[model samples]
Target: MRFIKFFFIVLGFSFLQSCSNPSLYQSKHYVFGTIVDISIYGEDEKKAEKVTKAVLEEFTRLHNSLHAWEKSDLTDLNESISKNKPYKNASSELIEIIKNARELERASNHLFNPAIGELINYWGFHQNEFNSMHPNQLKIKNLVARGPSLDQLHISGSTIKSTNPHVKIDLGGYAKGYALDQASKIIHEHHIKNALINIGGNIMAIGQHGNKPWRVGIQDPRGAQAIAKVDLLDGWAIGTSGDYQRYFINDGKRYCHLIHPFTGYPVQGVYSATVLIEPSQNAGTLSDVLSKPLFISKKEDRKDIAKKLRIYHYLIIEDKHISMTKAMADKIQFLNPNTQKNNQIEITL
Candidate 1:
């Protein structure tokens, strides 16, 4: 569906005192239905803008092609799915993304599902502005019973077909990471020394800002201030999935867009989950997709999921309680000392 998500992580950068820091150039754009910022360090302003413009253009192309409920290639695929029609000439890019998302979806124990777009739409997440209404329980029941999954869609070469009429492809859960990876490639091609790309809250760091690493802050779920700070090394990407953004409250309950494939309802109890991905073949994609299963899984099942996914660094805030892996605890500096002292911060294996 057409979804709008906010930054789950509060980002902060340290800049030099000089009013004209020629070594660093920054620009912000509105894309992916949110604010995207690009910063390049140790590069000329004109070169930075040129490179940034290319990245922005790429983002726009992906946005137009992958939009869930809009008039997009993705929507066209969904239409074909509903009618059991096969797309013979689909773009290679779309096919590759679907295959990648399906792989990640399977890796997530199906918790990171993008196939249930209709379920998301039923919850009023397809609109730019939510009317704050509870989804229909009967509709949810029917959809959940249908149990549309990514496996139902078959892909080979340029031809793609769906076996299930209920499956509606939505890449909202995975597009930011894909975009980040693409942006990184573009910047790397330009031989940019160091750069940062932020799509909504998903962030990727390349090289360093001058001689120091690029530092970022994870926001407090209840307030504006950062609760923790982290330093990003080269080729690292980080993101957070939280109920704080794209949610509605009704009858004293919060309904977020991170819907469960099994229950067909918004997940509760956890305020947010943050994930860090080390430099790898798909670090950006991992950073974006990995936090989702953590937020969606129960506390008891979290460790098993993390182990399965090989996720070593993570932070979870459930209600007022906090927990993280030992690696995360070592890497993050908690900005709120009271939070660190008052709660029994459970360190997961």
Candidate 2:
């Protein structure tokens, strides 16, 4: 569930010579076993650090409370599936997240089930490290058969109970986006106008740098020297999931970290998928969870999923072609196709 972290280096002192006094704010390994980098333009360095630290602390608190992999967090909820147990009440924050997860599960027809902790671990994506071993078909089938449905979860007020004994929830896919949204709220509350928050490959841009939008580069899956750049106009969160990021090559076949819930195996046919979503829209989690399924799904199903979820913009890179959502094609600027000899084409969704 962890996306590869790409560090953007701003090189040379010459680039800094123009700013009157640019304040750089950065916090690494903050939460969810990922590095978070925050850069605020034209803000006091001391004040920026204080705000960043506070936000990071809040994110960490949330992670400790909700992370299923952590045994301590599992104590807070009722684990009994056969009999409903009214355990300790859940925090408001946890309630909100569970609500959002439920909504996403319904919207995606359980394609984005958060209760797939066992499946994720079976595939070894939960370790936050690159997995070189590919699970056998029999193992995948067994894991999928034991996976729980989202409907088994019961939320009564602040309390939650599971109807399945083996149903373990993993918030890795949506937690980062949720943290970004929360951090953005904190920054806004502090009256910060312009900033950039990058948690792994998930990035959120707030306000603007003069008239220019935040420029983000999508890494090439084929291990090219340069990246495909995308320009963002106001505040939006962009996340990219790629099979090329954390994968294993075995017997000339590549196995990716992103596992299909139904098949319980790595999805193929697409190298990468990038999703752009407005902050006002709750599409970040949806995009993260749906990227793999959309890539492996048939063309008609892909279109149907996009329409059903109302995705704003997306780019799908397959072995031989590139497909773009209608919304993405309208705003995206493809730069320098000549830089690479490979064929590049755009399809309207």
Candidate 3:
């Protein structure tokens, strides 16, 4: 309903569902600040519908509790932090999520920091509806100078306190993937196979669609169609971070939500980033969280960061052209043989 994030189109699933088979069921909901799509294949309608409902319930719970600016546990924590008080009201679930987000933030050298949410709000992103407004340059600089790093937060059991008063937590980067993991858990517990859970553009696939791997189209950031398609295998996930999600044009500059902690400004140069993560305990989380750093990093440093993060399959869309790991190029089938034909294609090992 708000911003158009990095969304994907499921290619052949519609045809499979339209065959009048009770084995296919799908549903969509507006949650987690974006659209959520759930599809289950080869399950009876009753079972699929039940499981899908459970998943949506799980998403709604997460959305209500984790929302950064709303009256949520996160907001409560931020409020306490602002007043220099230790917050103990957070749920154990939220604590764990915060712990994981902190570790991920540290892993990215704080490039994926959620602690700069004060700066995020200063840019007017906390609103339910966004308008084209430029933030005050002096305020942006001050927030950047304050440097509220997630590492500054001390979490002892249920209590979370921040050393920097400016440290406000926004788990927007990680919540969807956490919800995906929870949905996967629900699907597994219910013994439902062959399901796809997509929150915004972060997607996870179960078993398969009948006998074939589920194919998902990575949406082109600048256009209406998918630039390429990939077979989303079981236990794997894919996600993209694009400037198109949230931002306004000012003086011909696109100021997006993916801000730089050190600069206190939206990142430029890159348009979008896509990452494909293998099955793991936190595959969904990694898929959701890792794309931001890639989108924020300098073009030449892509390989280094990918190596440090151990991300094998990656793709980046820049203003001029696109770049990707050869592993990613190998997995993706470009919709047009000459995608972005006007620009250069850079592939790395």
Candidate 4:
């Protein structure tokens, strides 16, 4: 469920003049098994470091709690649920994440499932080894036949239990967005004016960089070029999910890490999907989770699903075509004009 981190391009910023800009402080930290880069503008160096340090500490706390496979609080909770044992005193963070997961699971008709940990393991995605090796048909069939759903989990107050024995929850999909939201809160509490927090590829921009919108680039799924660029004003969050990030080619076929819960395999039909929305809407989780709807939801139902999920704008790239919401079409500038295929479809709903 790991998303490919998209690269952000700052249009008006220059790297050579960064040192002369004392109001800007930037640093990169290793958290959540990825490099998180944070930049703060309009703040003194000392104050920026203080704000960054506080956010980093928060990230450390969340990294230990929401990890999918690692031995952490979440793993402990998952182990308990797998054995039909309920954890009476789960953390509030875990409870909140699970509550959101359940809501999204129902909204997408189970297309977005956190209880597909077993299925993820079957495909060897639980480990870091994402190679040409795939699970056997029998294993896939068995898991698909008895796959678990987030609805099967029971959450009452602080207590949590799993009614299905095979249910194992993983929050890797929305974990980064959740982290960003928490970090944004900490940043705002510090009164930081302009800041950009990029966890892996998920980005949330607060305020503006020198009276200008924060510029971001969406990576081309088929190559290294940036296919689209966007300007993010205040309180904007954007993320991209691509099949190119974690994948393997076997017998001339490529397999990605994003598994479709219904089919128990990597989802096709989309090479990359980028979503933009207000972080305040859902604490930045919508940008992360909603980016994959083009691949997860049916074509006819995508607009309705996007509306239900509160996605403000989106751009989806396929093998030989592209599709975008009307909002995205107005905002996105295709860096490589040739990449905008002739069969482009506009979603207006």
Which is the leading candidate under lDDT?
1
- List model 3 lDDT by residue over 1-349, tens digit each: 2354546878874534645756668788899778888988887788888888888888888888999998887898899999999998668988888888888888887889989888889877887787667678897888899989878888887788888888988888888888888888999999987998888889999999888898899998888888899999999999989888888777777788888888888887887899999998789989999998898877777788889888899999876688999999899988887685866889999
Q: Assess the local accuracy of residue 305 in candidate 3 as a C-alpha lDDT between 0 and 100.
A: 84
Q: Sort by TM-score, best first: what order?
A: 3, 1, 4, 2
- Per-residue lDDT of 186-288 in model 1, one digit per residue for the tens? 9999999799888888999999878888888887877777788898889999999988778887877788888999999999888899998899868888898
TM-score: the better of candidates 1 and 4: 1
* lDDT of each residue in 1-349, candidate 2, tens digit only: 2345352322223223425435544455656676677767557788888888878787777777767656435434525432456545677777677777777777776767777777777766666565456467887788788867667777888767776766766777677777777777888899888777777777777886545666766766776533467665556777777777666776677777666778877787777777788667454455355564466556667777777767768888777678888888776655557523465676675
Distance from true position, residue 196, model 3, in Å?
A: 0.6
Off by over 4 Å in 3: 1-6, 13-19
**Winner of 2 and 4 under lDDT:** 4
Indicate the residue-level lDDT of 324 in model 1.
96
Task: Name the 10 consecutive residues with the lowest summed lDDT in model 3.
Answer: 13-22
TM-score of 2: 0.86
Q: What is candidate 4's TM-score against the reference?
A: 0.93
* Model 3, CA-based lDDT: 0.86
Give Cα-based local distance difference scores for all models: 0.87, 0.67, 0.86, 0.79
What residue pairs are clashing in model 1? none
Candidate 1, residue 336: the lDDT equals 77
